[model samples]
Target: MIASTSASATIVEFTTSHGNFTVNLHDETTPITVSNFLKYINDGDYDNTVIHRVVPDFVMQAGGFEFTGNFPLTAIATDSTIQNEPVYSNVRGTIAMAKVSGNENSATSQWFVNVTDNSAGAPALDTTNGGFTVFGEIIAGMDNVDTITELSLCGTTPMPDYTAEQCSDSTFVPGTENFVTIETVTIIDSTVDTASSLNSVKNTLLSTATPVTPTPTPSSSSSGSIAWLGLFFTGLIALRRRFR
Candidate 1:
């Protein structure tokens, strides 16, 4: 059964065959995109789906192929595609809707988890692929996302161009029935109702609790370059002052 997306979708939980991970929806930022995604969640469209396409160090894609036992199948009929809402950047751990190369508003259910700062691929997704809607980020289970990205390949380089909803052939998961599966998607409420909201009577002093922020994964190559540049500038300043 599909779980409810009724609560604050910001703390959406995904119980996968691999492990549990959570995503924080940008509901405030991308309302329409988040709404569309919630519809899929509500209808159980993504249940039992497999990570069909794995682009190492780039993305861990799923929500396309479904399965019964070891056999692969296409997902149930999807709702109409939502308009492009490309407000957020495709940085690491961010989850974005997927679409074909030429079509812009063709996304319906398929999505990807970016394993790296995909700014280099932004042009293909944003400028070329009609800006893949980035509506959420993985607040937890990013390690699971990383694991999915490192799964064994079923085919040789280029992956056989196998994009036809679902394939029953052993082509999808070649050697074993071990491809990563998104077992379940559930939205858990993390909101704390204050005494005031609960009852008009207040007896004790209430302190506003700070919101918990998820630690973001560093952009390896880019962040490292910036660190190196800072060190270089610091050394340059020290050498110039000593010589003077």
Candidate 2:
């Protein structure tokens, strides 16, 4: 794995059955948002969380909220909602929270994945309404997302039609199962893995990135000719002195 640059707060490598995606968390811009996500990661709450909803060209929603009709009520929706930090536009490969239409302060653990580049949802909330919070960006492994997009779906599988002035139920789960249920989500903190500096980097991880080979240089055999020349010069000087 390559070293993270200064812009990245922490490189979060998610090992999923589909594939691994390494996302860079903008902790500085969205501290609470990042912390909320990290809470689920730290508590092992997202291990078996299923990607319950997948709207092609929209977003993939997940986070142990409603798995196969089971909802965790104790799971705090959001004790205190943080101001929306959408400075970075909600483009493709961005990870943002999912919220209801009228309620801006109700983003819970559930989030969505942006399939297409949504220009309207960038950096700021829609003036007509409070938009989703754009916290982290997907740096690598978007193929996993593509695979989720192409999964088989069943039941209210598509977007629900909400009438005007209708209160949207954020927790509403259509009978359909859109994408493959995520077996497990493991959030690895790679920094701590390097704390001891004793654990050697695995060859598999290194081989995935780039292979570094050692270069071979010529030995000092060429210098022996110079030594011989110096000895000959000394012998010539001795002979010259004797002849003189």
Each candidate's clash count: 0, 5
lDDT for each residue of candidate 2 in 147-192, tens digit (9 for 90 to 100): 7666543221222232222213334433323224445444554342
Q: What lDDT does model 2 reach?
A: 0.45
Q: What digit string (tens of lDDT, one per residue) describes model 1 on residues 84-168?
A: 7776667777888776444556667777776776643322333334455777777678987676555544421112223322222
Candidate 1 weakest lDDT stretch, 10 residues: 235-244
What residue runs in model 2 are displaced by over 4 Å at the alpha carbon? 1-9, 64-81, 121-128, 156-179, 189-244
* Candidate achieving the largest TM-score: 1
Assess candidate 1 and give its TM-score to the true structure. Answer: 0.65
Candidate 1: clashing residue pairs, number: 0
Best by lDDT: 1
- TM-scores of the models, in the order given: 0.65, 0.56
Q: List the residue pairs that clash in candidate 1.
A: none
Could you tell me the lDDT of residue 57 within candidate 1?
61
